[model samples]
Every structure is written in C-alpha cells, then in structure tokens.
Target: MAIEHEQLERSSLTRYVSPKGDFIGFRDEDHYKEKLKEWGLSSGKGAKKEFLFKERNYQRVVTIKGYETYGKSDEFNTLVIEFQDGNLCCIHPAFLKEMQASSFGKESMLQVEEKDFSIEEQASETQEQVEKPEPKLEAKPEPKKPKATKPKKEKEPKIELPADKVHFTASVKQFALTYNPFNEENDEVVVLENVVIVEEPPIELGLAWCSHSKTLKKFELQPGDKLEFDGKVAKKKLAKGKDVEEEFIVDAAVQYKVNNPSKIVKNG
Candidate 1:
C-alpha cells in the first residue's frame, strides 16, 4: 500500500498503526525528533536511554524513516515509526499540530544602563564656574563626643516567592514511568513548550526562544492532555561549548500544591 503525500499537525508525539495494520508510523522525521525531544528520548549515539516499552537496559535509540498513512483522511489517519528495539509503536488517528505561536510579550522593559547626558552638561557648568572668582574658606575646631552602643532588632522572616504569578498551557509529549533498577515503582517526566521564539535584536538573547518547561510531577501525563500549570520561573542562561553560542530560557518549577489539575482543548 502507498502512503499519503500530505502533512498533518502532529502534536509533537504520536503512536499509531496504518488502517491495513501493515505499517507503524510516527510523524515525519523532523516531527519524530521533536517527539523524542518531548519524550525526553535521545537519539544521540552516545546517549543512553532506558527503553520504557521494552524490557531492556538503557539502550541507544536509533531512529529510522518510516510510513505515515496508508488510507484516506476519513478512513485512517496514522504515523509510522521504527525504533532501535524493533518495537513499532504506531499512533492511530493522528491530528495536525495546532498551536498559537507565542510572543515574549514583555509587559515592562528594563533599561539596565542609564545614559550619562548630564555629564556633558556638568562639564559645561564646571567650565563656567572656573571663570568666576573663588571664595575664601575658614576652619573651625570640633568638640569630642562619647561613643554609644546600639541595640539590635529581631530579624524578620524571609519569603522566597513574590505575589505576582504566571501559568502556561502545554500538551503531554511522552507519558511513561521510567524503569527503576531497585524498586518496583518508577518516576515520570514531561516536557512542554509554546513554540520557537525568533531572536529579536533588541530583546535579550535569552528571551528570544520559547520558554523551556520541565515535567510537573502532579500526575500522569496523558497523550491527549493539555495541562495548565501555575508556577514560578527563573531566567537561566546556558552557555554551549566554545564553538557553540549560548542560549537563554526560563526554568519553571511547579510545586505539588501549587498547580491545580486543569485541562484545556487538546489539538486534534
């Protein structure tokens, strides 16, 4: 059977088989890598990742080009993919990726450096004063004073968080409980994003990209789930190696009680 020639909005990650059940697919190659990024799976040859779907130790994920769809849009919608383990996890009824590209949307701007135009004015004023005559000064004797001890006041408590807040909606990229070596229970992580923020010359280079959100361990990350979370974020500057340039993104943290579970419209 032949695959369709059209592209669909893959919510970054998909697992579906063809209508004929003869082929398994993920999104296109670019999207597959994106899915891996969301899933926290690594395709780097040296990177070791424990295969969640297979009963194997940490293995290298060697991705390969695969099928997408085998039938019409109404009849069957899927993306095929191949894994290094030969496990073909195909997602059915794939939907095109729909998202509102976000903007840095700076509410306020900070001018870090203050221009010194007053220095030039001060210089001219100093020159004018120099042309004038100087006044004579007189000196006076001072009296001695006794030294006194000052009392210290009690210190107040320190609060880390500010009253201002923010939240963003994100989809579940990969939902899996990592395999534990010693215990039966496993941990989970979910990666979310808004979109690529182009570099603006005026804006700080760090604010150029979309916010980088890590997994909030509130609950299981379902494939069709779009979670809205409230948390505090800090700006982080990550410098690449000498050859590579540095990149900036915000680091978000969602405490257990901080984020109340809420859902939004999932991309079809």
Candidate 2:
C-alpha cells in the first residue's frame, strides 16, 4: 500500500532533501549499520539485493537500492528500495531485517479477537430468529443509579515557548529509550528534571525530554548530573506506554521537548 501523507506526519519521522533534491524520510544511521552487521550485508552502499515484500496476502520481489546518508552528519540514513513498478520508498533498515523471516505488513494488521466474531455470529442468529416473531416480551429490571463522584480538575494548558534558543539549567533524571512510532523502534532519550530557563524567557519546566543526539553523547551524561545548555523548547506531550520505554517510567508528566541543545556544561 502507498504510504499516506498523514501517516508520515503522525509517525513524526524526519524528512530530508537528498542530493538529488528529492524529499525522503531519514532513517537512524546507527540502526542501519547494526542491521547491516546482523544481516551480514558487508558489501556496503550500491549493493543490490532482493527483498520479499508482502503486499496484502501475496509477496513480491523488490530490489534494495542500497543505503544512503544525507550530508556529512552521519546521524541519519535511508534504505532505498525499488518496487516492481519502479517506485521507490525510503524504508527503515530494521524493517528490512524484520522482513527477512516474517511476512511484512504484519504490524499494520488490525487484530480482532475470536470472541468478537462469536458475538457477531450470535447476533446474526438472533436476527434470523426474529424474522419468525412470536416471542412474548418480559419486563426488564430498572438500571441502578451511578454513585456521585467528585469532578476531575481540568488539565492546565501547556505554556507557549519562544521560538529562539534559550539558556537552560537542568539535572539528568535518567537515561532511557522512548518509542518512535514511525521507525517502530525505541530511541535513547535523556529524561531531565528540575529544568529552568536561566535567561530572559523565564520558563520553568519541572520535567522534560531530550534526544540522546551525538552532541549529548559526547558528554557521557549520567543520572544526577546538572547541565547548562541552550536549546529551543516546544510543547510535546510524552504519553506513558506509547512514548516512554517500559523500564523507565516517570511519575511526573512530560509536557515539553528540547531540541538541538548546545554549549552543554556538566556539573555535579
């Protein structure tokens, strides 16, 4: 099936302009390399291989146009795959690894329980019986009234943040993985607590998240280490099960995300 524009937007996958001036989704560089090693695809770029792509119930052979990265940053890459009709899609490297054994599109299937089918079958049978019509109606018992409960307080609106970079001070809460739906993978992110804007913006964020990008990796940050940096903040909600990694669940809500943090200083 052709990927929809809305699906790509909801996935929050990064799109970049290739050298050929075409826009495509960028894959994680580290993940691509790891999959390559695991799959023993050591021949590197421009290597052609056949992948069995499952379209609905049938499978078709597609050509892997090898892997390519954007610019010198080595942060993200993409696997170019050509379909039988000569169309190309920038696929996640791990996706190809997954297709090796199992049929593709398995993850995209809507799972329905057998009980649901049984219920539908019973309803159909009842409808057929109703067609003959001679059953007497019985008086049904009145439904019990629900108990009175206190109303829940409305959630506070998220604060609007400045577009420009702001100086910040925050301490590392922990290091953990956050789920990325687009890639169907977990990304390493730094969980920060006690965050505060030290400059003119004057924003105080109790909890936040930042991706463990190459720049942050250089510091080798640990839990409890205090950091000072400049970054642009945006309102991004982090859902517990959907966005957070299972093992590293935070008690507090995360309402903001920090992007492109730079000039980092670590302190005890």
Candidate 3:
C-alpha cells in the first residue's frame, strides 16, 4: 500500500543541530513559507516526485516524502525526503532544489579539501612557535601608584510575570525589522513601549517585542497608538548588534516578548 502524506514519517531535520550547536529549523509556518517564496520553490503539495541529491562525488535518487510542520504552532517546517537507501531527512527546500543541478557538490568537494589543508598548515605553525624560545627582557624598577575605586551602579530589579494570561496596556513605539538568522534576512517586528500589566502583581515592561502577526496587522498598528490586549509575556531579549541596529534600524532595547495577543482594543 502507498503511504499517505499525513502518515509519512517526520523528517529528522527538525532536530538537526548545526556545527555551532544551534538547531537549523524554521521558526514558524510563516518562516517556512517565506523561505519557499525566496527560493522560488513550490510548496510541495502535489504528487511525490523523484529528484537527484548530490552526496559527496555521486548523485543518489531521492523522493519527496512531503512537507511537514512540527510543533504546536508549526514552529519547525521543512521538506521531508527519502533517500534510495530508505534514509529520511528534513532539508531546506532551497537546498534540495539546488542539489538538482549537475555540478552541485563538485565545487564543494574542493572547498572542503582547501579548508582541511588550511587547518593542517595552522597546526604546523603552532608547533613551530611552541618549540621556539622567547627572548627575555631586562626588568626595571617602577613606582607603585594607588588604584582608584569606582562606584558601582545599582542593578534594576527583575520584573515578575504572571503564569496565566493577563490584561496588558501598551503603546506602539515603532515598527522595525529584526534579524532572522534562519532565513539570513530581517523580519518585521513591532516594538511596544510603556507596557504594563493591568492585573495583580502589576509589572511594567519598559519595552517589549511583538511580531507583526495577522492579529496586529488587522488593527493596522501605527506608532504612538495605544493598545489594550490580553496576552502572556516572556523574558526575551532583543538583538542589539551594531549591524542589526544600522541595517534594521532597531533602536529600542526590548526586554520582553508578547505572545498570542488577543482581545485587542485600540485606544487611539
């Protein structure tokens, strides 16, 4: 019996760890769609088709099992493919498409050898330096000086967040793009200022980040617009790298992330 798309085994790529120890998975369903569009690849909704996958110096026939989304919010989505040997893996659609070219892995093999040669050269240089002795310099007497003490700055108290959803009031500070490492591009994110919890243990989050999701898009949020909503907040730091600030124009140092905002009310 032929396997159904719904019954296909999950791709192993969702849990794949990169060399840097980070998972190379999509952030959400939207993220996967964006990647597909960027690569000009289809959503893989039609019949399964066989394609050539380059492995080292040879090409192996592989069949597209189907595209699948994992996690509650489709946090990890990718194309699942089954190799000739029955091995299955989740891969980026763009990567799979590129493998269809005849010379996909040819240049990569040479690059790998060059990288290994460079590492060997570095090791030999390190050994030569270790065997060589350092020349000693004569020491001269110097006057001792008293060290100056600097006053320590007070640390800000951490905000306590509620376990359950709470009413929130905030003003849209600005709209900016944030770096999405998975896509190697910027994603639109809304920055909220003067955020406050309306319920007990009322806490204030000076700045918070919320994705420009469909819910917010419906409201057509603008800067300085006051908004009231019920949602949960979590501690998530906004990236503040020099390139991120310059390229994305993200000025605020957001300290929290708003999740699943609903009951949104625009208060002018």
Question: TM per model?
Answer: 0.18, 0.45, 0.52
Go through the candidates in order and give each one's C-alpha lDDT: 0.33, 0.65, 0.67
Backbone clashes for every candidate come to 14, 0, 0
lDDT of 2 by residue, 218-240 (tens): 78888999999998777776645
Considering every candidate listed, which one attains the maximal lDDT?
A: 3
Task: Please tell me which model should have the higher TM-score, number 2 or number 3.
Answer: 3
* Higher-scoring candidate on lDDT, 1 or 2: 2
**Which pairs of residues collide in candidate 3?**
none
Q: Model 3, range 1-268, lDDT digits (tens) per residue?
A: 3543322332222233222222335456655554454344533473224676665535566765556544333334467666754666667666777677676875654467799999999999999878666778868769679789899999998666776778999999888776655345566778899999996667888898877875589899889999999987777777542355554566556878887688999999
Candidate 3 similarity to native, TM-score: 0.52
Judge candidate 3 at residue 108 and give its lDDT: 57
| Candidate 2 lDDT for residue 189 | 77
lDDT, residue 238, candidate 3:
70
